[model samples]
Target: MKNVNYINESKEVFDVIVIGSGITGGWAAKEFCEKGFKTLMVERGRVVEHRKDYIAEGKGPWDFPNRTKVDNLLVEEQYKIQKQCYAFHDGTKHFFGNDRDLPYNTKKGTEFSWIRANQLGGKSLLWHRQSYRLSDFDFAANKADGHGNDWPIRYKDLAPWYDYVEKFVGISGNYDNLPQLPNSQFLPPFEMNAPERAFSQQMASDFPDKPVIISRCAHLTEPQKIHVELGRMKCMARNECQKGCSFGAYFSTQSTTLPAAARTGNLHIAPNSVVESLIYDEATNRLKGVRVIDNDNLSQREYFGKLVFLCASTIGSTQILLNSKTNKFKNGLANSSGVLGKYLMDHNYNARTTADIDGFEDEYYIGRRPASLYVPNFHYEPTRYHKNFIRGYALAGGAYREDWQSYGYTDGLGINFKEKLMHPGQWKIGLQAQGEMLANRDNQMTLHATKKDKWGIPQIQFDVSWSDNEKRMMESSVEVASKMFEKAGFKNIQGQATERPPGIAIHEVGTARMGRDAKDSVLNGYNQSHDIPNLFVTDGASFASSAVVNPSLTFMALTARAVDYAVKEVKNRRL
Candidate 1:
């Protein structure tokens, strides 16, 4: 960090301006700067430095003011929407946004949970770290089913980029050669405990079509030279990642991409600068810059750039595009297709089933494991097709023994209860569904007619909801998980659909999708705006469909590839 530059105001026109310093924004900045292009990375929140800023790291539940539970009053007033997140707790509450300050409305009967991490690292600091690569099945799902427009690019277009990013990011997993869920460049995978191994073996014997494997994640199971040089270490399995990882064990903007970007002298960052909208120059038919409002104060400023990449989260990027209206494209900037704010999609993560495993009592595992056991989608395979739903889902679960913490308000007392609590209880297995969501034009988000935020930006209102396809998928998931458990000889299998809102998965994607034609999509194959060449969106907003897996790794690969293409286009003087 010799010449690391952080500024609030800048008038110099940069070669690239990246909006939002989360996962993709960090990669965009790193790619451009390393290519010798002067880049400006803009973040709409306060700076969160890597090791020095993890205030809650290395601390246990006892250190927190409320024993790892966020205060009820604070949650009610400030974290109404964010509280719904699985990672939202007192230990990591600082990473979540104050929902009262970030207000938006849902349509009459629909509900949305727009989980936000408003800081320099964005949600990268708070992500669950499950990294997965979508296959041709996902890319071609929309075209085959006619749910949405066809994706202009396919898996081959992104496989090399996935290898590039995965090696640098240090993904840990086994090479499960499933076509629907492809393998990634990986480190040594974490080991499954005795119970989980038994569970996997039984599932293999019973349901051989659906292979059960260890989940892939961005943990440093074995640090490579690239990761070691970046000051990251093997995962210690603290499992408190939302509070931040000081060892850089998990991939986050603060740990990996930001440091790499800052190592180059050409990188400049503007924190606390909330972009109001993109500055589209009608004369050049290009995105010239952006207009932003300071997060703390109400002062306004402008940033000039030759090219701009919107790496803001799916909703945030779409909000900016929807607000950036011009004379030529009044609907939104680069929204010539009239699909800027339509075709919104999110993963259906609602169905859950838990069962008790009666054996493996003598083998008690000690520490927490970073990843879960995953069962990939098998409905697309021959003889395994479904009737009600078109797309499929993946199941994530693990086998765990009940500890003292698992018992709550027990009615036992004295010596009998104390002796019983000393030993680990029966091995329990829990499975959660991560189903694909169909891209529907009816599930949309639009700018409010009159509502505005504190910074005078139009508030976004979401009308997105689970369609019949998603509901049927979740319902099928419950039955499928219970049947799998029964086949594995697990007892007490209870399965039910938890009808959660659309955005609760926090994997909300699309709303500005990439497609083959200009009339049906917002971006092209290169993630460049169909109507504006100099503008690109490499975030989840550019996804055409919600693939049935974690989408962060795809986001990383696309951003790196987009930057490479954007630079070549610039050298050709195309912009």
Candidate 2:
């Protein structure tokens, strides 16, 4: 187990100080530590040890006191926004951030549900783990459409880094050879059940343009020597991942990167340490250290580092940058471009389509597969773009026969009704569209001038909303998906367009984007600040665009690539 400390003081100026020990921070710490750098990871939440801290792991729904339902009073008071997430349950409520204690403001008319997991692992512990690689189609979307700043780097630049991270993370997938969704270095893929196989074949036969494949995820389907050495095992397919996986089957900070970083014996962790802002030295033209607040007592402390990586969540990192006001950059640190908090984006996941399949009653599957079936974006290719919307969206779902779980919701009274539901019900399939949200400068966030949190940090005020492009894209996805289901001879086909606001996807990005020009973007292609060469922000905050696929895998890839560049530059004394 990684020995983590919750101290308020440190004497040494560390080689690297990684803020936010989540996905990117874990990766940065592991990479930097493995390269022999004295690294310190600061997290605002309690230290949750692997296996020991997964309190609800392996427990059934009936095991919970409230039957996996969070208390209503607590939900109303602290989790009003987080409750919207499907994964928020009694078993996993401890992992979510208490919204009452961590308040933020949104525009009067607009609502953004900032679902957060502000723990030692951040959202890495609660992430869906559906890992996908972005392609050139995603990298060039902004340049082609003229919606946002152009991506400084392209797919080719990050492809090797994706492979490096995938090999260590143990991604389970197939080589689809699709241009829109590139393939990763994959382990043995989890098998498709009977109904899913039938649906995949049928989808291929009916519409070759939209191919259904197994969702690639960061799970150890087949543990490699390295994974085994790390004491991780193959995925048991419990699908109870949100509560935490004691088996270490999934990729999380505790299960994967934290241990690796600790194995180097060069990592020092400060849990319950919330970073207030970065301290910059005007004379040196480099970041001096970070200012931190104790999450429990609100005590202040400082930790200096030669290099700093801000791996906080999109909004959280931007809030830090915006709050770190200085005389040289009066607006905000690295805000000379005046675009630090603009062009916010998240996945538009409000649309859904469901239908009932005819056959496959006798073919039920075993074990709960954590991942669903994936259909990469069929529209918005390099050679073509959707007429209605400039960007595209991906579809993800699975085919499953209703089991005994469905009986719980039905109106049944007698023994016959119980016996009837003992057998499997009809096969049902669903396709939910995760559309691309175009970047809009008007949709932005800023720190409140007067409001402050208990820790003396300014409260973030969000003013982001979906644009017409997102609405059109969602409608187009529903139309395309519903048509596909209808042509497949499915019954009771239903299509829906939701009114749920942005940030629900929890794939927020693009507050501090990367671009070629420092006048417009905050970071360069390497995720280093355009203004401060030694400072980096490699998390979702550095995303130029929120592509159709899940962003975690891309974040890991970017972090690895950026760390490699940053380390080399530091060695050469160029940073």
Candidate 3:
């Protein structure tokens, strides 16, 4: 790689330029800078410092303006898409994108919720920290069913990188020797409450294949030397993680990657810089730099780099690429495979079941646990019989006693109801089903030719939808959840489908997928673009299939592995 230090009077350049400073971007910045590249990370919003920015972390319910009630007018005016997420409340509203400021179009008869945070840390600050690895089942699913394209790599390729990330990020979970959802290097799994423990035991006894393990999360249950060195503490067990953890208890860009990258003295961050397009050099057939528009002023600027990592979220990154049309690749930048915005997917999560547990009246646990109990996927085992669907879904649920807030349904006058609510009510069990959404080309995203955004870039129009296969899987998910509740001896069982909408799972994946051949795949095994070897995309965009498990951990592993490969390639002058 050339190390030219030329500062154009108008344009700026760096060794490596990363777009979007969320989880993937943070990792890219950290990796590039640590690997001796002067990195520039551009965030479309303002800077949010670690501890200081978490304003609502220590606040109580009374401290909120509406006493935890979300402002209805604000929801109507600002966060129409963001409100769909349960975490969008008064305390954490500042962390989400205001709909008025960053608006995108959706097709008629289709509802697309693009929940986003353009701030320095991005959605990483407010993400549900549940972490899990996608196994060969996910990578081989495409090949097995002929749905999309086979994954370029398998679980073995990412396992070591998973270890590398888990060791530093501090995941807490039991080592459940499950092949489908592999266990991570954990700190210590949080203990479940009495009712949850009872449910776990019942599930284990009734269905041996489906074990209920504590939610594997990136939150530090017990911080080690590495975490302490990074100025992070163990999780205080406060469930108020979406408000941003002031303790640095959870894994966010502010807590982990950004600080590590900044420590290298090679990181340069340009906040309020919205990356509009990639400057593709047609003669060289490589990405030379990026064209960015100032988020505040709309002023344009260009930044050069030896390499670029498009870590913008699944949809956002693809939008940038699709907009960067050049003569060499008229479809999009590095879109030679014609799969730039194809196979767009998010986990099907509308199938859910909730119930009230009758027992465990005297049992109560202290501290707000950040993790839930996870029942791993039980469908499609070699001997197990699953008639309806090829793929499966997992269950994440837990038991929580009714707090002082449960009195909203009661009509008891005043003091009596208040006292009753304070002590806790019957154990409530709520389970959400996360079913795998197949990678179908018909479920895709395209740039609207006529609809342009404020920056003159075309608005992304999604044509994504679930197939009969996904619907079948979802039906099975509801059945499994209902049965699990019944087997656990829970009453008042209610199962309902919330209906699938685009991007609701926050696990949006597979715009530019990995595959065996350059003609068919946008990225190879190392996340290096098949058409442009110098550029890599290690985000959810490279996912071949949406596995039942969460995609963040897989992205982390892929990123770490890709960074190692990129470093080695740089050392060998292979670019």
lDDT of 1 by residue, 1-575 (tens): 44568987788999999999999999999999999999999899999988888898889878888788888998899999998999998878899888999999999998999999999999999898999999988887777767678999999999999999999999999988888889999899988989889889988888888788999999999998999888999899888788899899999999999889888898998889999999987998988899999999979999999999999999999999999998998998888899988988888998999999988868987678889999998875323558887878989989898888775456678898888888788889998999988888888999999999989999999998888878888899889889888988899999888788988888989989999999899999989998998999999999999888999999999999999999998888877
- What TM-score goes with each of the models? 0.98, 0.98, 0.96
Q: Compute the lDDT of residue 563 as modeled in candidate 2.
A: 93
Q: What is the lDDT of residue 556 in candidate 2?
A: 96
Q: Model 3, range 1-575, lDDT digits (tens) per residue?
A: 01212122235567778888898898888888888888888777888988888888879988988987678987888888888887888899899888876777666777777789889888998788889987777677777766678887877888899899899889999988887788789999999999888888888899888888899999888899989988999888878888888788899999988888877778888777788998887777778888888777788888888788889999888989889888888998888889899988899887778899997778999998888989888764424426766778888878888876776776787788767876777789988888888788877789997977677778788887777777777777778888989988889999887675868888999998888998887999998988887788889999888888888888888887888898888789887
Lowest lDDT block of 10, candidate 1: 380-389
Better of 2 and 3 by lDDT: 2
Q: On residues 265-307, what C-alpha lDDT tens digit does candidate 2 reach at each position?
A: 8889888888999999999889989999989988899999999
Q: What C-alpha lDDT does candidate 2 achieve relative to the native structure?
A: 0.89
lDDT of 1 at 396: 94
Worst 10 residues of 3 by lDDT: 1-10
Off by over 4 Å in 1: 381-384
